[model samples]
Target: MSKITIALEAAVATVIENSPKDVRQTARQRANVDRAFAGILKLIAPRIRHFIRQYGLVAHWDDAEQCCAIAVHRAIEAYDPAKAQFTTFVNWQLRGELQSLRFRLMTDQRPSAKKVEATTVSLHAITVGTEGEEASLESMIEDENALSLTESAASEQMAGDLRAVLIGRYVDHLRDVGMEQLKRAARTKRPAAQDLAKPRFKAPNHGIDPADIADMEAKLAQHVHLVERRIFDDTCLDDLEQEFGIAKERLRQTAKRAAKTIAELAAAEPRFASELNRKLPQRRRPSKAAVQPAVTIVPDQHAAHNLLTNVVAITPEAGEPLAESIDARLAATLTTLVSETLN
Candidate 1:
């Protein structure tokens, strides 16, 4: 134990011992408590600073420091010397408050959270031209028909896999409830000391056992099936209630909670994220002239030159593969047309 721990222990003892009944009688006690708290805060200032730095709560230093003060106050009030040392007790409370502060500051709904939902982008939606072409933020950034057939098939397969993983999570959640029930039942079955003193041949194990494990597994299987039918299969809540003899409202709540959990799981799980967040392919769009009809120049006569016998097509400068060849052909056609007209 360090000097601060010793000081805190003494402070806690002073507060407990000097505690008074009436407000008028508490002046001396209040003075002592305040002195003790002052000493405690001074000693733990370094610790408070460490917590702020360690948890990335330095931006909210004032709030974090206030929380530290509250934790110190709460620790002094609630500390049981027999259970834990003052240092251990206060540090736990400090950590909890700081974690909560970090979570509050970083949650999605706040503009200060720096999350994507906090930012706004206008679509700038417009329609133009004879083809009724649409221009918008989505069109500018995203490619048309981004996913190929193979990728779509893969996403469907991954969806099934994600569903299976979510089912396992739901079953685990149910099993936790079952375990709690078993613990309560075991506690109820536990006999008194006198009952235990009267030794029988076989003493009952009033706790979870192999038999309970098997029974819980059996029930969990039924719950897994119920989750699949109600949530994944989209079976109506009333239908599930009628089939399972459970209340419709109860079934609905259970399914709702499971659905929420599934959504959280999908958001957190990387495989699900990769499958779900399919970014639009940023494919380069072909220029308008590339898709336009080729303009053909038909000459009346090929009298002087056999070179101009073939019909010529003039295509505009579009980002096409055969652009150079088309340009060369157009120049030849234009030269022949001019020469023949002069002739």
Candidate 2:
């Protein structure tokens, strides 16, 4: 076998042999484990540094390196050959640790390119020749600044794209249903029949009495009509009390009693029994339309331009023209994907 492979096998064996069957360790064994850990750290430092640089974690390289070391140590302590290969397991552990560190740094706003550049320039000036150090620091700072700006712009664009995607999806999905409800609610000046239907009515068997079925249907219809009217008319509990000449609590009690009667009636009918199994009441569309036609308030190009300018002024800098353009393109692509998938 190669020297590296042999060394790895030896390390694995050392770890397995040194770990006690019991949780507790003797002083000698503990010392041996510590020595083994130190050896492993030495072997893994270069690997950790390579991973850090690869991930563009130069700003927090020290913390990233320390986290990698901790990850490696954790992997060693928790190592079980039966579960996975040591290297494979350690790599997974290291990657998770690094990702967590990256998320924390990104969200916390402590590690910025400007701060890193300043630190780098100071360190370089102290150790290197003044002119070369100055040039290098300036170059590094400019590059870092550009990268930061690009990343910020990209993030803003992404957020806008996501927002538009959600809004479009939600609005499209609910458009027909919401409009139907609004229209239904508005026109009758009464809530839809379905909303106030008696919950107690059930579909009777073929052999059941026609009178019983008819009575149940009539009650269900009445209940549905009443609830719909109450909602559509915007009748508050106080309004109910005033209209019925009863206390609010008494009105609520009466409604509850009415609901229970409906539920019982519904339970007797097979169709309504199935509906009663549902946890919540059914929603109905409004009779009235929700949206009105757009009005032509501005007749001239100057008026239109002024309106557009006002809108632009109110919009956030993050949501301005350049950012919005990128966001719109991204949203269009995503909308196409959504349409294709639904189709």
Which predicted model would earn the best lDDT?
A: 1
Q: lDDT of each model, Cα atoms only? A: 0.78, 0.64
Q: Go through the candidates in order and give the clash count of each.
A: 0, 29
Off by over 4 Å in 1: 21-25, 108-343
Model 1 lDDT, residue 68, Cα: 91
TM-score of each prediction? 0.32, 0.30
Candidate 2, residues 1-343: lDDT per residue as tens digits? 5555455556766766788887777888877877776776676667788788766688998899889978977887787777876767788888889888876666444466556553222423433345555344344545647878999999999867744443344334334444455445445564336645657454334234456446555654554444433433446788766655667776566566544544465466575567668788569867886787567854444664565553323457656877879999999999999999999
Which candidate wins on TM-score? 1
Give the C-alpha miss distance for residue 73 in model 2, angstroms. 2.6
